[model samples]
Target: MNDEDHYCENCDMDLYGISPIYVDYMDLPYCSIDCLAERNTYKKYKTIEEANREAEKNRYRKEEK
Candidate 1:
């Protein structure tokens, strides 16, 4: 795969060559992931614990049913 051959589904640029990233359901495509990771590494999402702390800050469940 060559970057010149395939564009990143995100930035529309030929990135990572033409290697199509595998995205699971609810996961991001190559473009979004690349952007989140600053374009030089894989994207990183918050851990469960980290998410809990962020969500627990002076906040009630917004729409949890």
Candidate 2:
């Protein structure tokens, strides 16, 4: 496939538009930070669920104040 046709491995979304956040893992392209996190479980990187939970917590904290 051509460079323009590259898509994210996890979400299957077109990669060109969000290329800034693109990550390469084992020669595959991921389109977003979250997509990269979802695929890799290395140190200091949060999983999708952990990121979502943190976001939810921040949202609730905002609602309380």
Candidate whose lDDT is highest:
2
Candidate 1 CA-lDDT value: 0.48
Candidate 1, 13-53: lDDT as tens digits: 65453445635663334544545344333233246455557
lDDT digits (tens) for residues 1-65 of candidate 2: 45744888777887665653544445667777877777664334466567678779999999999
The global C-alpha lDDT for each of the candidates, from Candidate 1 onward, is: 0.48, 0.67
Candidate 2, which segments miss by more than 4 Å at Cα?
1-5, 20-25, 41-65
Scored by TM-score, the top model is 2
What candidate 1 gets wrong by more than 4 Å, as runs, is 1-5, 16-20, 25-59, 62-65
lDDT of 2: 0.67
**Residue pairs that clash (backbone atoms under 3 angstroms), model 2:** none
